[model samples]
Target: MPPLHILHIDASARPGRSGVDTRGSHTRRLTHRFADRWQAARPQDTLTYRDVGRQPPSPVSGEWIAAAFTRPERRDEAARAHLAESDVLVDELLRADLIVIGAPMYNFGLPAQLKAWVDNVVRVGVTFGFDRSRPGEPYWPMLPPDKRLVILSSRGDYGYDPGGRLESVNLVERGLTVPMGYLGLTQTHSIAIEYDEFADERLRASISAAEAAVDDLVGKLARDFAEAAKPSLAVA
Candidate 1:
């Protein structure tokens, strides 16, 4: 079986402690456990890490927008170079079989750096397309059919669940999941840990609960991988 590639991304700017830019905190813990399980399950598998918090690219510009939409063969030198960084990031995402994103909710939504990464990767004609002719079917995905996405989110407040008080205003889950679904990644799961109203003990408990959820998710992924590795018998 070919080795599965995991693209692990952490969007937190904080290295430690509970603060606004605490991007890497939850993800660091989750990814550490994920990597351990993945390596144990598939010894030959590779893990690629991308830290968007510490080094974030500038927001997309008009030139990048135009260049990204242009046909590769017809693009001028300047236009080709305009989207080089973004293109590279998108390519990394495309090559991965599984993606694990660690994002913290900031100002009721995702961080600016993570948003920029999303903009660069979720390009039309690349990750997705629009099919106007098919009535009521507005969009189509260009990504591979088998990729999976797992999101680990840390929230200051716990109000994003269905029928929750702040569900109407919460944009973090809705924003991320919609785009991921649009890209044909249907097997999506999330681990959300709320830290606002909890004391140190309670916060630790929440983290523990979230970690257990992650363990369960990892087990499922490993089982799926094992099943995929089995050879199918040819029918006469």
Candidate 2:
């Protein structure tokens, strides 16, 4: 079997330590460890990393939008070049068998950098298309059917269950996952590490717990991969 291509995206601006305007460092740590485990399990697999923090693009502009929406054949040289960058990003996503996104909660939502990445990739009639074919199914997802996604999220406060004081209205996970599901990526999992209540000792414990969870998940994924490689027999 061929190696699985994994696209790893880290959106946290902070390179290390958690502080105001930067809290997703833990998410990056956890995802790096997870990626390590995944590569160890499948040595032939390839991982591509994209850091949106240091290289955020300017907001999409009218010219970019026009270029993006225009048909390839109709686009001029400069317009095609502009759209090509976005096309490359989307193509990378389309080529990957798995996607891993590291996001930290910002103002109870996704960091602006990550949102910009989404805007660049989720083009109309590409990732998704509007179809009035059925009365209810207005939008149809055009993404590949075989891709899986894993999200590593970190929050300052804990809110595992819904409707708690620290329960964030940010809804970044929901926003990403629902769209991924809409895009036909049904195999999605998220691991969150919360640290709002952690002191020195408690913070260490939180990190330990998060590491263990990643280890356990890695083992399960490896086992599943091995099982899937086995040939199935049909009754005569």
Candidate 3:
């Protein structure tokens, strides 16, 4: 079997993006730490990266939608060119077994940049398809069963988890998880760093917790990848 494929995405859009390598960007640091550990543990694994924070894809437009829905063989050269970026994104996603997204909560939602990337990839008859089984409305992910999504999120406040003080206002975390379910991903995981506005002990503690979670997740995933590569044992 081929090496496990991982897709890494960064979505924090700090002013000038100067904070990429600093503690100021909790999400970005978390993702990098995860990647570093994964690489050390499984050097053979493949990793592909897209930095939406620095260069976000254009928003999906009417033309993009039309081009995407057009039959593969029928789309003209112009349409194909128009959807070039989206096509690559969707293809990259299909090729990856594990997707790692680092998203910072902005006004309780995903950055517009990351949302645009999501819009580009979630194409009909591509990433997913119209569900023929149910009437009214039905859409099912076209992806296989083994794909997974892991999100690292940062927030300016705490209490975003279920039953937390700010859960009602929390949108970024839920938004990221729910969309993947729609995309047919069987497993989704999240590591969050909160209390960012405090810039005190709370923020420090949150970052540490998030980093520890990332390391643990990367180790487990590396082990799983190794196990998956080995052939299954024969039945007795």
Candidate 4:
């Protein structure tokens, strides 16, 4: 459609891009390349980048929970203050047409910081709706159905893809997918570099492959979204 608004999030604790730093984060490299490629293709599009690894949002606490459950209009000053950060995060998510997340697997799961980010965005009466009377469907996704999600991830070991040896234990992508899907961002795609700990030819190959995949993904998504946004012609 019009210029796309992309939200780029980096959740790696490491400071530098891969290949540049000996111990850099692979996810960062992919995300940067993705953003660069996207901008080169569609110069008019806008990007909002958030580095949650270094500056994570506040974790969900008792006060945050209390404030979230409280009705917005009924909330007092304290309640509003508790949810202020969450409010900003939710607003950013709502504005994005495409969300790109750089998440590296930490101990078979998401990093603590990224999880905290997730907790903040999945707000009540904001990204989702809840009702006590509706027994069959008490919860509903609040975001529009067309929002797209891209998770560029890295892992210490290999075989984490679907049907792979370590798929069951690989919770990085699944963890994000469940929460994001709950918010109606089901158009998801993921590409990850594996064998990170090995730091050998395998890791190098994986990174190269992942970069190519990211480029392909960016091109495909940019074209697909543009096509989908075009108006259809009426038949005579």
Candidate 5:
């Protein structure tokens, strides 16, 4: 099978890995471990890392919106400048078969940086297409359906999963998956570490379980991609 290209994005404000740094990010730890496991299992697979936590894309502005709405051919230098970073981001997203995002929940939602990254990538005429002619379905995804998105998150409280205590309020996964799905990345998987504020046995256990989940997810995805790549045999 051909080697897959993975885009790894870290969105935690906290730097370094947990247990390595006294006050490190659990999301970072999970994402780093996932990447390491992927490399160990498939050394030939390529990875592109983007640290939006530290170097975030600029927030969307009026000029940026106007530029994005403008036709590519008609865009002037100023318009291009407004969308240069977004273009690079969209290119990265297009090249990646698997996207891993380490999103530590901030105020029960996404971090400002990750939000900005999402805004930059979900551009008109790039990730999604819009048309007034097709009133029934004017918008369509531009990305292929095969792309997969894995969101590794960390939260201070527990019970964020489906039917959990805080399922409705948990916006990290919903916020990310919705936009990603709109871009044709409907294959979304998420794993999170809870009880961060407590920092007790629950926190430790959550971390361990989340790490194990990451390992399992990586192995499963690797096998799935490999199997899908195998050529089908003709029947006589």
Candidate 6:
């Protein structure tokens, strides 16, 4: 296999324009850390970045719906025009071996910009197939289940982890996993910096924990890709 292709998506509204702003955005920091770590380990590995927060892909419209459902050869020029951006988004997703999303929890859920990206990529008859004739499991993923999804997130509140006090209300992971699952991304991992609103000792501690997790996850992924990219020993 060639060097691993990584797609990095940043969904936080913060642009990291200023020194202070960049320092404050935990998601941005974690994403940078992961990208740098990967590149250091394997310079050949590719990284394609999309900042949805700043330049969000257009939301799906009625025309998009019609265009998506229509058969490719049958689609008119108007339909083709409607799905142009969506096609690009889906293609980017299909080309990646690893995907890293930097998400900041907004109101206990995913940011609208990130949601738009999800809506664009998880298309019918493209990323997923719907078979009405099937007795059960009508919707099946069409993409290969080989992608690794890493989510670097930050939350203003705590207890979002499984069995945590506020786990029931935490929708960030579910929001991402459900839609991405439709596109066959089952190898998922999340590292969240919680207690943002707290902005105190607890917040610092959360950031520390998340930073450690990022180091561990990126180290493992880099190692795997490096090993995979190595040439096998030639037989005599």
Error of 2 at 121 (Å): 1.1
- Badly placed stretches (over 4 Å) of model 5 are none
TM-score of 1: 0.88
Question: What TM-score does candidate 5 get on C-alpha atoms?
Answer: 0.98
Least accurate stretch of 10 residues (summed lDDT) in model 4? 15-24
Query: Number of the top candidate by TM-score?
Result: 5
Error of 6 at 5 (Å): 0.6
Compute the lDDT for candidate 4. Answer: 0.93
- Tens digits of per-residue lDDT, candidate 4, 1-236, equal 69999999999999889888877889999999999999999999999999998899989999999989988889999999999999988889999999999999999999999999999999878898988898899999999778899999999999999999999999999899999999889999999999988989999899999999999999999989999999999999
Worst-scoring 10-residue span by lDDT in model 3: 15-24
Query: Tens digit of lDDT per residue, candidate 1, span 55-143?
Result: 77668999998887788788999998888888888888889888998878888888999898888888877899865787887888888
Q: For candidate 3, write residues 41-88 as lDDT tens digits.
A: 878889999999889999998888889888989999999998999989
How accurate locally is residue 108 in candidate 1, as Cα lDDT from 0 to 100?
86
lDDT of 6 by residue, 1-236 (tens): 57778899999888882124644567888898888888887788788999999999999999999999999999999999999999998998999999999988898899999999999998999999997998888998888766889998888889899999999988888999988887688889999988888879998888888888998998887667667668899999
Over 72-175, each residue of candidate 2 has an lDDT whose tens digit, in order, gives 78989988777766887788888888888888788778889888887788777788887568688788788877677888888776664366566557487876
**TM-score, ranked from best to worst:** 5, 4, 6, 3, 1, 2
Name the top lDDT candidate: 5
Q: What stretches of model 4 exceed 4 Å from their correct place? A: none
**What is candidate 6's TM-score against the reference?**
0.92
lDDT (Cα atoms) of all candidates against the true structure: 0.80, 0.77, 0.85, 0.93, 0.95, 0.87
Model 6 bad stretches (over 4 Å): 17-23, 226-236
Better of 1 and 5 by TM-score: 5
| lDDT, residue 3, model 4 | 93
Question: For every model shown, what is its TM-score relative to the native structure?
Answer: 0.88, 0.86, 0.91, 0.97, 0.98, 0.92
Query: lDDT score of model 6?
Result: 0.87
Candidate 1, position 1, lDDT = 77
